[model samples]
Target: MLVDQNDQALRIGPIHRSVAAVTLSDLSELSEQRGDSFEVLTDRERALSCWTDPDDDMAAFAVSDGQAWAVLRTKRTHEVDATVLHESLLPAWHVADQQVGYHHSLDQALNATSRQPGLVVAVRPPTLAQVMDAAARGLRMPRKSTSFSPKPRMGVVMRDLRDA
Candidate 1:
């Protein structure tokens, strides 16, 4: 899979169906587990309950008691250019300096700039602080500034979106 110009191509073999596809229920459970894990670490947090019904390819639902949010969706995966994402992270830091309200994704801020293709996943608001901190400390980041948590298992997750 090709995420950007700097990202090296990731080669993956055909998926093995023996491992049942991830379901909505699975995601909901994972979310709950994650929430609970977080709660245990902080009393201010709580785990939300969630469930799901089969949709498209999978069945799922999620509920966050603390956030009062629910997400239900089919099981699907796709590849996005990770390269443009790398190059875009810095400019995003400069943009984050504006918004007063709490922001979620860096891509959201950049969205107001332009709609050119090749953008990757959104960058979290905290990334702005990180970018500034790095500069203040006289350091440079390589790419994909900060991945929150639970990044997919390296080889376990692969993309086949590259065009040869």
Candidate 2:
């Protein structure tokens, strides 16, 4: 939640409030088709701000302000290729500890022997003081440390549960 220094909050959700049941058949065929390690994140489903340019269909998204920007097409599933997932495009932010229970899982499955896979750290950035404190303790931040907003834009438009 990148907020204004004055403490203004950004709107963040239109969460789908319904639930549905899925059948085994629905998962069967879909499970067989293995998508790449990286998957496309859909905007229609998430509470994200999107600006469409009148000049062209090109769009810009701040994955994390001052850290990453993504140019996407005006399509349903704007599939960004695997190449963009490389560190050059979206560098790591807050990743320190590497060894974990899942280390072997990635090593064996991906045939990767990296002790530190340099993966994305789904965490928020620490304050300047916090960063200094960690540095003093010889600790490092996680890769691409960022605050993940579960519900991005909310409260702008409201719906009454009961009719007037």
Candidate 3:
């Protein structure tokens, strides 16, 4: 079933999900290396404000260590995908490998900072249209790139063999 605005099931009680990344790398170091590709926002409040407005082309990077937060806007002229994060953002910050951990919720990501020295990165979830387009083009999205709600319960649709 389509999950876009046209879907009536989605209209009733839509499920919302967010993804955040926690890395041991400091924000300052990342900024110094990829300054040209990102827009840095030192004010935590401002960075949080920017996140309130969703944009497919933009992702917010925040560090609780006071180094500052950065926003990365995709350079692609057409549709954007998770590749921007897997290919550019994560690598630029030096967390392309196991140095980074992903949280399904923002709160989890924010709280992780107190336990270690690191930064948190939040990105907009891919839209259904984007997922469909990518599939049509034979492209595979990175892991944890999207989350959907109202998942089916196990055995909810099961039937006894004898009944059939």
Question: Can you tell me which runs of candidate 3 are displaced by over 4 Å?
Answer: 1-26, 35-45, 52-78, 154-164
* Cα lDDT of model 2 by residue, 52-155, tens digit: 22212222221211122222222222122111222212222111233211211212312222222222111112344544565698854433332223334766
TM-score of each: 0.21, 0.18, 0.64
Clashes found in each candidate (C-alpha, N, C closer than 3 A)? 12, 21, 0
Model 2 shows how many backbone clashes? Answer: 21
Candidate 2 regions with alpha-carbon error over 4 angstroms: 1-5, 17-21, 33-76, 79-164
Instruction: Assess the local accuracy of residue 130 in candidate 3 as a C-alpha lDDT between 0 and 100.
Output: 78
Per-residue lDDT of candidate 1, residues 66-155 (tens digit)? 212334332322111122223332232232322211113433423422333211122212233545566698866544334433335567
**Top candidate, metric TM-score:** 3
What Cα-based lDDT does every candidate model obtain? 0.29, 0.26, 0.54
> Candidate 2 local accuracy as lDDT?
0.26
Candidate 3 lowest-lDDT run of ten:
11-20
Highest lDDT scorer: 3
